[model samples]
Target chain A: MQCPSDKSKSAMLAYVLKQYGIVIALILICTALSFCSPHFLTWPNLITVTRQISLNGILAVGVTFVLLTGGVDLSLGSLVALTGVVAASFAHPGDYPLIIPVMAGILAGMACGAANGVVITRGRVAPFIVTLGMMTIARGLALVISGGKPVSNMSPSMTRLGGDFLGLPIPVLVLCGISAVSWLFLKNVRLGRYIYAVGGNENAARAAGINVNGVKLLAYTICGAMAGLAGVILAARITTGQPNAGLAYELDAIAAAVIGGTSLSGGIGGVGGTLLGALLMGVINNGLDLLNVSSYYQQIVKGIIIVGAVWLDRKHGK
Target chain B: MIIRSSKHFIGMFLLLLSALIYSGCNRDAAPDKKTATDGSRQLVVGVSLMNLSSEFIVLINKAMLESAKDMGIKLIITDAQRSAEKQVQQIETFIGQKVDAIILNPCEVEASSPAVDTAIAAGIPIINVNSATKSTPTAFVGSSDEESGRIAMEYIVKRLSGTGNILIMQGYMGQAAQIKRDQGADEVLAKNAGIKVLARQTAEWDRAKAMSLMENWIQTFGSKVNAVYAHNDEMAMGALIALENAKLKDKIVVVGVDAIADAVQAVKAGRLDATVFQDAAGQGRTAVKLAVKIAKKEPFEKETFIPFQLVTKENVDKFAR
Candidate 1:
């Protein structure tokens, strides 16, 4: 009995290693890259990486929640663009108080998200198709509202959200805060358990008295709201609301989630892993920049890294 | 379960609270029509921009607005966000408002013809700026795309000694800029047998996308790539970032157009070889001036071609803002 127990312990260890193998590999890659480039380990470079990660980190957090409920939010990126433009309109200097623009921006994002939720839940359409349609529509709306122009002169307080906080960007802080709260929610909240249940087996979750539709709506809403927040932060950072802002951000968010060990099939990941994935991407981009890699080659390397992570995940059955 | 319910309730409450706050805020912040400059009897001018989100367009618009203000012209601005449909609607709105003159930076040359016609039918003299439309306007003010492309190619050929593998990162497919630039690059490539065009792809004017495309090209071509020519500075900047990452910063020469702020800085830092300066602001000022000229029956050139300068490290400081 004791010998069998030891074998089981080793098996559990192997399983855990397999599940987190990509993260370990990512660490190893960072170490190797750091050794190769002296600037890779610097404080400023690290902070830049953190700042870059915040965009995807925030999006991935929302994506993780959706993935937990076996759904996807393709409109998050477009929502960001739309919200950025809308918020920028409100951010006209001396037009209104700071809170007005900020609240309006947040509301715009929520409304967009709510619309997405309604289409997916009430309309009973597939989340993928619904979001894909939304992506175009929202982007079009963004362009329309801004009159094909970039909205500038955003409120100073809004811009402050993108400013530095204790040597780090406010966006990075927000990302960290979001990550911590999401982790806690996933681990300690019953809705979190329901999300996992729904992803693991929707029919089972339904039978267990979980309102799966409500969970999905919540997930998508969160995704939209977070994307909205990201847009606001991005607008603040760039000091302009660009209709073209957050273009192709969805790919980055999805890639980060997958690389961080979120199974595409859903129900197997958390914000912690997504955070790691986002960090990995950010570090790689910063390192590449530091090493003077051409932008074209950087993209190729990013694709490879994403594929490698996925391959490793499959190989380890995680 | 209780904790979950309470959290859900809190979330719902926050959502409702935010919604109420938003409505209230919007109500308080409505733009006052009465405060708007009264131009009821003035020759109203409508400015339809392709997109204002980019620095290039923003600068152009600012210049135009300044010119309009100086001339005491009443101008109404509308943004198309790069949508032909939206641009059409904006033109219709201008027509409805009975503007005396219209300035357009068409999103698509052909797609904007109907809208241009609509304005023309309404007797509004149109001045197309930065980009030309298929329909003739009172005057068109923009740099010659073909010439700029030739200049860019000339710079690259001079730098690479006309013998090397080069990659061409195209802009949006079927756009006037892409067509002209490609034509110019092709003319040069056809003549220089030693210079090989390794790969061509569209960066779509996106820095990140351009960076990724350039990265892939580098990975495929490695040190064999002698130079890169992007349609615009943003894409070039993206390529520069990739080259910097791969430790190939000084190995390959990179050229771009638009000579944007960042691109100019890159050239100053010796990271980029050259960029073509479009003087977008000048074009804006010129467009507004021409619109007012046509509105007032003043003679203006049928077509005005703005001169573009090839900016390099030697001449970059002169162009710096």
Candidate 2:
């Protein structure tokens, strides 16, 4: 029989493969597309893919925490819409300082997230139902606030948040910052350890004196704030407070997390994997666009790839 | 076995044919649909709309409602809510109710047409509005999507002197507006061989998405794109944002469609070069008017086309109003 060390080493190898599979997939797609499209490997095209993926990347990082804690937030998309229009309303030309509108948008999402937490914890409602209901409410509120149209003409300074910083686009920088901070948070903080415990086994966590509800509330609230930040970035980038922005975005975020090998049952994921998953999605989109593939076939190809990824993951797990 | 199966097929076919004939002639039984016999300058017209949530569709609904009030016509409106099956059900309900005539703002091109056929088979005159159906109706009252694109392109060709590099921001692919608008742009491109198309992609009728797409194009082909032609105003407004950020606002001449309020403001401010006026209110009014005419058996044209006009800075006010 193999020694315990050898078995654990094999297990470690398996874990790494499962977790870093998305990175490998992204590299392969990039390599293939680099050969297929003459423009695919260029610096400008790669930057385009990174910036395009940033919004969804930040959202995936946020939802990754929620999924790790054995819950899902379906309201992220609508929350993005709500925060975006709110940010645009305040960020209108010379209306307010840039920070005020930016914070206002993030705070709105936090409040909405906090409320979702309260209902799920205090009211004993399921996370899916609570977030689903909030999804509709938030989308309707976005429509009402924006009067069923896009809010435009945001301040120039406000729009600059979506522009370049140093050498990189502000959104990609923001995405990088969020990912680093999230990685550290998961690695270092005491609450972070408690989060893993709570997700691993709620009853065991409660027995161990971990505040399960508090940890859950923290996860969901952070998810909300991230969603808000994403909203601000998109609105500023587009220079509009669009109520219709981020439609069905939650699906993409969830898909990224899942494709990155995050367990839906709880307690197994990280920002690194999520980033790779987001990059894979971004590369696929860029590659398809570069090849001038019709959006219809693009959708079909994307769906099949997602399904195939999950199927391979499941088989690997077995 | 072949003979037996054929007999079963014949029986099912006969059953369906008789059912259609029965439903056609005995339409007076349903308590919901009022017959024209009791009418005294009172007409009941049933209308099925695509989706009520869209701002443009809401404007269409408002115009129709206003026309209904002014003409003293009783209108029963059904919201299809973007579901083709729901639209089919609404059309069937209109048929069963035996309304004088039916107005259909189709949710889809083909799925919504067969139901309109059912209303026709029931002897109900149908008026199709805005988007077309696969099968023709008694009357069609709306501006063609292709015509909107043509008006925008014609103006662009004039401004560019028939030759310039341009970017095209499309709507949702396979959507009626996207296909027809691209056709119009392609027709213009075909004529002006000197006009180079730098890039074309579907932004899916989204402002934020379009803005990012424009930003990517800027990165890929900076300073090369001389103009932008968006399938809709939302995308145009987004392109305007990207251009303004890159300080290309003064260089590129951008045009769009729909003439939505924001686009109108953009045009008025001289930020957007031009936008094609889609006349949502006009389509709504004409649909109602045609429905009443068909109900009253008054003389009317089979198809009424609303003209799409280019809304440049010079003619912005007229289109805006």
Best by DockQ: 2
> Model 2: runs farther than 4 Å from truth?
A1-7, A32-46, A122-126, A300-318, B1-45, B72-77, B92-101, B121-125
Per model, state how many residue pairs clash.
32, 1
> Number of the top candidate by TM-score?
2
Q: Look at candidate 1 and tell me the lDDT of residue A299.
A: 72
- lDDT tens readout by residue for model 2, A203-240: 99999999899999998899999999999998888778
Give lDDT tens digits, candidate 1, residues A1-318: 001125677666665665577677678778988897765666655665677688789999888888777788888888888888877888877788777766777788778777888888887889899989999899889977876666665666776776677777788899989888888888889887777878888998899899988888878887888888888777776556778877879988988887887767767788877888888787776666556565467679988887887778667753
Estimate, for each residue in B4-65, the C-alpha lDDT of model 2 and write its tens digit: 78988998999999999898774543334333444764678888989776778878988999
Candidate with top lDDT is 2
Error of 2 at A302 (Å): 3.6
Instruction: List ranges where model 1 is wrong by over 4 Å.
Output: A1-62, A70-75, A78-191, A198-243, A251-318, B1-41
Name the 10 consecutive residues with the lowest summed lDDT in model 1 chain B.
B27-36
Clashing residue pairs, backbone N/CA/C < 3 A, model 2 = B33-B97
